[model samples]
Target: MPKKGTRIVCFSPKSSSKSNSVTKFSAPSRFGLSPKRPSFSQSVMDRTLELAKPVITKWNPETTTFAKVTSLFHESRGEAKDFIKCVHNLQKAMHLLVTENPTSDNLAVAQNLMQISMRRLQKEFYQILSMNRAHLDPESVSTRSSRTSIQSNSTSDYDDDDEDVDEVRVAGDSIVQVEDESSLAMADLKLIAECMISSGYAKECLKIYKIIRKSIIDEGIFRLGMEKFGSFSSHKNKKKNMDWEVLDMRTKNWLDAVKVAVKTLFNGERILCDHVFAVSESIRESCFTDISKEGALILFGFPEYVVRNSSKKVPPEKVFRMLDMYTAIANYWPEIESIFSFESSLPVKSQAITSLTKISEYVRTALAEFETAIQKDNSKSIVAGGGIHHLTIDSMNYLSLLADYSNILSPILADSPGDLPESSESPAPAISRRFAQLILSLLAKLDGEAKLYRDVSISYLFLANNHQYVVVKVCTSNLKYLLGDDWLSKQEFKVTQFAANYERLAWSHVIESLPENPAAILSPENARECFKRFNASFEQAHRKQSACVVPDCKLRDDIIKVNLLRKVLPVYREFYNKYRAKMGNERSIVRFTPEDVGRYLSDLLFGNVGSRSSSSSNQSSPHSRAPQSKTSF
Candidate 1:
């Protein structure tokens, strides 16, 4: 006889006085064979189809049939695998019938049966998955075990000869253990995904991928717990076996859903920015939780199979990649801006900025985490003293990207008064002032970050460079519209001030030795002595200031020299011209003549000291001596 749950398709001989023949169809291996077949009478064939038709029809997606499938396995004293195979047999039998008799009178019956049977196959697969998932949890596993025990005790009511079948079936069920549930679900999901993808349901495949991803991520997050996110994690024992590679691979796989969604949403026609944002939000929520709370820490990176102490902080590469992913999806400002620039695109509601602002907050959090980690590392002597210099480069670039959308970001960053006007009628100048204020606030934060460096001189230099960079970037871009000329003037002035502060901190002694009045002399001897003092001071100042390093060359030439030499050089030249004639043949005592000083001053910054011979190459040209009227800011 066939296995109890195996499907048997029996066919009776055709009419017209033909031989009373019997035909039996069984899927050779997947389906068990019948040892002794009953005579295939017309009534028996009809009864077989009658019994199988309702099973196919009732096993549908309209309702949950997981319990029914579970009951079938228990009632028949068969394994879940056997029950599922029996369901597949029904689908295969109908398929065979359609292929064998496409032109026969029974074609419609065969085709409809095949259609329902295929659907039942899908529904049964999901039912099996659901059933397995139910028992995956510890509490549910205990409950299922108790329930199975009760069912086993009552198996005697079915048949005495079936006790051995029940025992074998129980042993088989035990093999579908808790640890194997996720693997089983993953296998089934891959099959379902292949079917969906081949059938042109890419979005459905993506949905199944999300389910598998979430299960993996939730388990990983639970294992890592809340401590893995910390800079100085204390749960050392708990993290000893933490597998970051596994977490990273799971994250990468989860992120692939985004590609599928983008393809589905944008494959055929022009998609609106609002719709893209909506879908991106859905992906973000599924892939990562709002990690604002303590329990969830973002873990995103390429999978690297290296063993390290788990209590050690999460690597910057992982943290940075996590932010990159967040920026790509959750903070898709570039894509949104590009689409919205087109007049044909639909307008997004202003409220969309609220969600975008939340993403902005995440970016801010990421930057903060990076700064904190760099600072902590520097403090521990594990890193260089001036690490903030490197940290600020990327942080400043990210801030610049964020600042590009100042129209929306200003409202978030600016401190608005409670009695302020409605968003629409607010004056342009007021918004400009708010944006300018926000930029200033961010610049101040950058300054604070730079101070994390132990070297105070390098700290100030860092501030000067980044501040100048931001002011220049803002002034050149569309951001200038919201940060008006006055704001630009103010930021430029601040940059000038920072440059001055840096010089004063490093150059005050160079200035102190200059003669108080070298141009006014009583006699040739006094003029020569005063000129001697002036020459000594100027040469020392030139040498010391030239050696002082400004990391950004353009900023060095532009702001530093524009502000410093505009005040110092003209006075020095006037003193030199007045005294050189008074000294006459002793003029060679002055190391740098007025014209020589002019040429030398330009190259002082580059450290190519005094080698030029052309008078036109003098650094103290009229343009250099006068106030620099056209500041780039």
Candidate 2:
């Protein structure tokens, strides 16, 4: 048999037989929605029909009984096609109808049929979606190439010389010849994303996105001017009039660029993030007249489109491709705005206040979603398709967003409502304990620096100031929507899962055993205790993981290495501070970046706080405080 949970029921009337027909055939729409209409080309229909024989044989060995009793259903693909062709044959006189032989009602009827057909096609698509097959996997885009059709009538393919005023191109002859010719193929990828949304092909959309954004890092285009919004349009009109390196890109190369961009950012590619941030800044400067510098920080590397530059006489669609590219790069993330950076554009004083405001907004959103998820138990609705089979992506994304938004709560509480900290004043909060206390709940399960959501995770530092927040839950009620049932339960250990469950055991065995609330004075002891627990957990998970026997010895070693956190003292301290920092704010928890893990650990194990930080000595939060013996976590 296939994997236990791998099988999905084939609803072909023949396989269902008489006893099962009422549930499978007569009851067509499970959600009260109309049956899905087939598409114009309807490429999957014949294929689905071909698949029916195998599926029926596998699921209903009693199909012979149906044949013997009655041939009531059109069980063959040819019969189904004949029925459809006959239904459309009446449209052959459409030209006569156009000549005033038909009433407006006739047009309306035709439109309804079209709509119904479309809807049925969509339904068929979703039926297949129930399987969550590899054809729509999130990491691979070419799984269904045979069925994925493209319009060949599109404009030029490889004209490298046409870098016109509106276009952009890279200086490469192989990808395309002219920078001016917009790639029909590249546009197809973007369109594919849009189509996926309509077709409920979200997983495929994500795959297309991965192909274009972060899968390949060397492609400078992915790292090109993203962090900035307006910079894309700011290219001197002379340059706009000049050829855009943007055009000469082949579909594969364009996807290569995008995949590289997102992959590196997710993989903690700090340098690439820096590059995206710079471009994001340029894009903003070109667009937002009243743009705040703080916005640059938060919005950097967020996936979005370049808006129309009215003053520049640019059409909005012209920026569509850029946005498409950016979207393709950053589509996996549901919430893509930069609330913190939006406000922190000015001095430390005002920036702090502004950051608090954004943090509040972010928290509000997250709180709402988290509450809804809890109340409705909507995991099933969140992840409905079989393609990713685990719609756990949203729940994990929402969880990480919760952690990030909760991160800044402490800082917000630490600052006085009326006054901002002075340049000469200590950067540490006046009431670190309260701040830590408030954030502890939010940071309870935080294991590592990054806010990963299990198999799918991303770490970015372009605008290191951003915080995440959730929008709404997957469903209003679990019964109403078929969101994943296991969303909330399984994601409790998001950070640890990303860390291969090492920190989970570490924290539970050690950190959670400590006081719930710790005073500043006792924080040092708590930190040590937490560190000890972390080490223990790491060792335990490490040993068990190492014991696994694989044909390749390196496989086990790699598994340990990939999941292991090299214990460095300062990393513990920063990790501790990050935990502490979340206590007061309880809303704005920053996800850990590799830099936070790498740099801080170096300082803890060795005294040197790398020169990479401009204010190495002035590290803002005092994470070293540790939990007091009497305090509760």
Candidate 3:
């Protein structure tokens, strides 16, 4: 009031305070621990207390000099006590005001302050009720859920200011009220999904997984990713710009999302299936974006989970596919020599090997393809002709788990005990020979692969020089019919030029153990060795037949020649007729024990000694010369 043009500024009390009351001050911060004034004039203090006296005069103590003491006691207890002298002086003025004059302006100011305090209290209550969690209703949920939905979709990274809004966010309902700020996209949703799974929001993760899976699959991007070969920049149809070849950002997000969710759902595994091939193929393509060591590790996808619902083993096609996935992983991540790196992570090693063990049920294609691919790849590398061994050997690690697979077959056969025909001369005995021959062929092929890996190519001339060198040791505690030296010499293989290397290496040194008729070695001797052991009941019948001494008669030899003709001439009947003699069924084909049978066969066809089969000279397979109907088998 003393300063002529000084403006009076009053700020209302803040909402955060404990109570509402009349507060007077020259400045709003007066009671708020502000710095002290240099010197408050006594006159100013006296005037302010005097000024407050008239306003507080209505409060009475109902005693003598009560009016005079009004300002000291009628005002707030704390303020009056702290400046009791100011209050005492004000009490004198209050007595004068009560007896003489009153200030209407003071009464008006108190009324205005009471109104301000009430309004503040009402506004605070409204806000508090609006945010109370338990107070939310279903209608309110729907109303607010829309807003929350919008916030969740918007990738704003959770601002603290959102907390004010989050309180109003009831699940299951809420309008998506996106503000002017930045928002998230579908791709962002995928990223969020990944984070949730990593941090163990299992429930949230599964929910997000379903959402993204539906989205990506509906968009047809999953199939697209699976089929799209990576490294497109190096492809024959290379796009002019790298951007053109790059996968859509959405595809990438979908993969990261689904992979994380799938991993979490299975505790990080997939059921092995045909789709796993595509999944791996997809992963390989994906890592082409960033082929760092970490990227390479991830590029090799996880083995899909395989479950056997029945007592029956996993199907061959499915098993083959699982093996394919292992091969793909091994081939894709070459920087890590062992993609599994079992030594580094026992859990990973255990899981991977366990996965491989499941594939042990079906061994044929898995073994053959794996063995072939490794040998081919390595040989290419050694000779400096083609691709890297890294590509093939990577596959071999998964394949090698099956080193124990073949033995599984042995027990199954032993437990079931399939009957062997009575004589090598029986029709069923031919079937046994064929089966043994097939096993030999399989061993030979496997040996060829192993030899290629071992770098045993000293020269072309010394091939087939190691036949009896234990190509395979099938241990039924060693009742195994091994590939003896005689078997290798007598039977010329239906070998490819590639396979001929092993044959040559194994057989060149086989002359030392060569028998005149090695085929005879296949049969158990009925003479001194096994008449009693063959079981006297069966042997007596054979002894009465006098089967051992069928000399090389012309008629028998002619019959054998005819049997050979029938074996080889189905496609060449025209040429066989030009030879202008005759052909007939194997007349002696059933006459003797298989041992004598084999002897008669060699002498008749190969001329006594130091000679090869007349039929063996014609070196060609149906594959090389012409196609034939395999239905004949």
The candidate maximizing lDDT is 1
Q: Give the higher-lDDT candidate: 1 or 3.
A: 1
* Model 1 global lDDT (CA atoms, 0 to 1): 0.43
Better of 1 and 2 by lDDT: 1
- Model 2, 1-633: lDDT tens digits are 111211111122212232211112345586787665423212222232333333223222233554333221114433323323322322222223334433434444443333333233233333332232232222232211211132222222211233211132332233433211222223222222222233233443333233333333223332443333325444445333322233323222444543443342222222212121222333222222122232233233222112212222332223333333333434423222221122222342242334335433333333444434433432332111101212223443434332332233333334322121233233343333322222232232221222332222122110010111111222222211221233322322342343333334322333343334433344544555554455454344322322222222232232233333333323444465545543443222322233443333222211122333465343511232211222111
**RMSD in Å for model 3:** 26.4
Report, for every candidate in turn, its global Cα lDDT versus the true structure: 0.43, 0.30, 0.29
Worst ten-residue run, lDDT, model 1? 267-276
Q: Which one wins by lDDT: 2 or 3?
A: 2
lDDT of 1 by residue, 69-159 (tens): 4433223423433333333334344434544533433334434544444444444444544566543332323222332232234222112
Question: Alpha carbon lDDT of residue 391, candidate 3?
Answer: 34
The top-ranked prediction according to TM-score is: 1
Q: What digit string (tens of lDDT, one per residue) describes model 3 on residues 34-64? A: 5544222222333545454443332322323
How large is the C-alpha RMSD of every model relative to the true structure? Answer: 19.1, 34.4, 26.4
Candidate 3 lDDT score relative to the true structure: 0.29
How much is 486 displaced in model 1, in angstroms? 8.0
| Residue 429, candidate 3: C-alpha displacement in angstroms | 34
Of candidate 2, the 10-residue stretch with the lowest lDDT total is: 462-471
